[model samples]
Target: MRTGEGLLGRLAEGGRRPLVVDSSLAALYAAGSLVLGQETPAAPWQPMDALGRVLILLVSAALTVRRVAPVPVLAAVIALWLGYIGCGYWPVVNSPAVLLALYTVAAAHRTRTAAVCAAAVGVTWVVAGLLGGRYTPLPAVAVQAVAFPGVVAFLGRGAGVSAERSRRLAVLTDRLRAEQELRAERAVTEERVRIARELHDVVAHHMSVVSLQAGMASYVVEVDPVTAKGALEAIATTSREALEELRRLLALLRVGPEGEPEGAGEAAPYAPAPGLDRLEELVRRVRAAGVPTELRREGTPFRLPPGMDLCAYRVVQEALTNVLRHAGPAAAVVLVRYAARTLTVRITDDGNRSAPADSPSTGGHGLIGMHERAKIYRGTVSAGPRAGGGFEVELRLPAPHAAGGEPVGRPHP
Candidate 1:
């Protein structure tokens, strides 16, 4: 690994080798002090003796744990350096370790505490420099003692501030990422529910017709060949339509881009979703399934958003399918009404109210899906037996003008 990367990794793991740094600093100070003591003319610069060397090594060794306990390390180093100075040795030998301890304290603590510590250290250094007895000028000694520690403390405080900002930014970025994932999961759940409703509507409606026609064809095949042929033909057409609708739904679940295939616009025209415009065909299918069905419209019709249109269509389709399955030997009527700000579709069937408790029209997924679809547009769904003794499902949706462009694709009444 690169030198910088290796250092960063060590820091990240909380395993920085403080001993290596301290040993190197200790060696440099010991050798520098011996050379300076012999050459310098200052009155306080005494030759490096065994005691002075021991004191300097003690101060340097204390700094190995400087970051772990900066305040204690600073106190110990200051005490050892004072002993060295009292022995008539230059105080500069141990000054680097003192400054380093102050820097650590500044970075790890509050600004006021670090400032107080820096000021105390400066005063102590100034007194030690004065012990040189005018060898160094008073002004120069005071400035050196104060300015060096002050600058190191300032840099340490800045590092602390920068580290805090980085930590906060990391936390905020993680929170944002979590929220985005939550939203994505919620969207996926909603889309799955919609697709399931579509599948239920498509499969349930077409299969009901196919099943009924197949039964009719089998029952009348020996007695009436012509009628049997028509029933068989109806089953074939219903199954084909069911397959096409299923393919469309499957297309939505595909993992790639949802745009049409290359050259599809010309090869195969885009098929619009089922909507109120298909009510006539839906009614006819129900009529063929041996349920007399009627279609009616009131008020001026208007275009609808694709989602709202599909919602209305599915309500009607699901309601009629329930009629076919449970409302035995009955008739159904679908009414679509357009208002200034709302579109309503009501499907009623004059069927037996005594259907089994498990009927899809009564508290089943069909009814629940209707309500779910309506709620997406701030709409409502009401389904229950009417006062006049027939099942009814009504959907009322907010249909502001902004939801669509113009009135078109009106279903024939």
Candidate 2:
């Protein structure tokens, strides 16, 4: 059985006062039979006789089986006692078998069934007592029968309630654990997306610049030796810088103490991050890509947060890519201005050539990614075709480190 039921059964066995009471009563009956006058009973019906000893032994054994087969065993014990009464035996004071059977019925069965069994046993006890010349009032016998079953039923209900409560607690604990795991997984997913977007923006912009300068250096290797050398140098510097940044990002995936010295065999070469100082080279590469562009800077330059610099560079890169893909070989202008508390970047292209209908729209994840980056730095972005037949993208990013830096009434024109 379950733990709760087992505990109740053990407790019931412990509280068996009726068994002790019956043993004492049997001793009294034996003493009375031994000392009484010869005229009291000279036959086998005497309590000290073999037949009486046999009846007592049978009743004692029946008490043990009451818990296993209560109702049926109770019936057998009652029938045996009725036979003793018919054979002229006197009624005993205590009946352990009858008391234990009542308790078992209440503890193991439904309330209604236990009540019926208790009543039947009580009536049989009283009727047998009357036949044996020891009748008791009906009301007194009924009360005695009901008491044992009632106590057992109460104990059983208590055990059942405790079991139900434990089950509910277990279910609630599991639900809470599941919810915590889901939240942790969601957090990891969001961090990965943020990292991927940053990597894409960083790699794409620098790679585009390298491609443009490399192509230029190849074209003018002999025809324009001076310009070709300058282009090659720019290409080499850009490539070195890109490699360094990639290594730094990869290092983030390692498990180690911060700033620990690398072993000679473990040392990995890397490049430094590029900032606004390289804007000139970036512009030249776009120009070489056949999209004539202009680069302008305003306000006093100041240090920028690393994330902000990366985001600014990505916005420019994505805008230029869109122009090359969808704005045809038209001229584009890039303007960068630092004001009281904000930095602005605008790229505009006059749609003079018919862009291929199959060209992918700029309103996809590219624009969404840019918007997400801008929002990280407390900024806003607007992009669409201009009224005069050109596409324009404007971004405004806060620059807290710059003098006069603050959010503007609107993005710079």
Candidate 3:
């Protein structure tokens, strides 16, 4: 009736419990049989003697291990039942123990094996009926023999089926939960990588310019007041721009419950991301930092997808920053080519000096960021010291047929 309430259920509760519970069951059954045997008068049947009492105790004790070794226990209990009957004792006193053994066997084994056990117990009952029948009718004995074991076996089969289904459902639920956790962890790792890459690009580019302007301003403060004043102004303007870009990056972290910005109602909208169209402004800034820079366009230009546009612009900015920091006294030229199916940007410097051991152009975080950004668009970036002089970084990206490329809705940092 309950989920796990029968003989087999009690045995499966835990290790060491079956022995205690079954021993108690056997003791109760033995005591009841002894009391019943003493009360029965010596009429319609001979009264139980020492031998009959001993057989009843043996059959009750066998019930203790019915779940552990069901088949052997059933055989032993049936043999003891026959012995008790042969001693001229009423067979009904031992019938309950025999039927309990039959149910134990059915619950513990497959249907075929349980059915075989049922048949064996049924035959034993018929034998007991024939040998000990004093006043009971033969037809009634025949019906009892077949009906009792059959119904018990049927109930035992249902218990076995229910237990198996519960086990399988528990396993499936655990497997699905583990898979969901794994996927969540992977998504978190990817988002962290994206944020790290964006932070490196933004900080490296802006800091390089700030460092150059500050140094220039300090050098000319007393010698040429006007030149020094211009340098200081450039430094302040560059610092303000860097702060605005950092604010944009921080905006990515202000998420609300619905995935919108936390202060969407009060805060101003974010400015547009810089793209190839901003190359002229970028070149002017580098030139003002004492690196004579030229921007050139070869092929016809057209609008690109938002994701690809950002990727292209970041690559160029990273390359120029590397040139300013590593290629000492370099004059840089940036060439942008917008072909029918591809976009390529190449930045080359003409400094006679080789980069220091830890320069970004000489394989550092800046170069790595460039390559990572290009990869998002199925593009490639190559950077190294040019054979003639200075360093060069070139990137190539394949554009999709439609304007739609990788999504740009990803958080910047």
What would the TM-scores of all predictions be?
Answer: 0.79, 0.52, 0.74
Give, for candidate 3, the lowest lDDT window spanning 10 residues: 404-413
lDDT winner between candidates 2 and 3:
3
Of the pair 2 and 3, which is ahead by TM-score? 3
**Residue-level lDDT tens digits of model 3 in 1-413:** 66336556656664678788888999999999998988766677778788878898899889988877788889999999888887788888898998999888888799999899888888888899988885778888889889998999988878878887898899999998999999999989878877877777777777888889888888988998898888778777777877777777677667779987767777744667778878887888788788999988876566677778888888888888877876787799998876667778998988865564236543466777777888888999988778887777899988564356442222212
**Backbone clashes (count) for model 2:** 7
List ranges where model 1 is wrong by over 4 Å.
1-47, 86-88, 130-136, 173-189, 224-226, 251-258, 262-269, 352-365, 402-413
Q: Name the runs in model 2 displaced over 4 angstroms.
A: 1-161, 255-309, 324-331, 336-344, 351-365, 375-379, 396-413
lDDT of 2 by residue, 1-413 (tens): 69568656754775667556645654554444334422344343444456665665566566554554556667777776776666566555225455555666565566676667766766776676566543457666556556644565456545545656787899989998999999999989977877776576657656766776777789989899998888877777767766776776665545356564243237754334556556776677677665799987766566677678777777887787667666765788888887767778898888653553124543255677789989988899888878897888898987766544334344434
Task: Give the candidate number with the greatest TM-score.
Answer: 1
Over the stretch 218-272, how does candidate 1's per-residue lDDT look in tens digits?
9999999999999888888888888878866765555345565434544342357
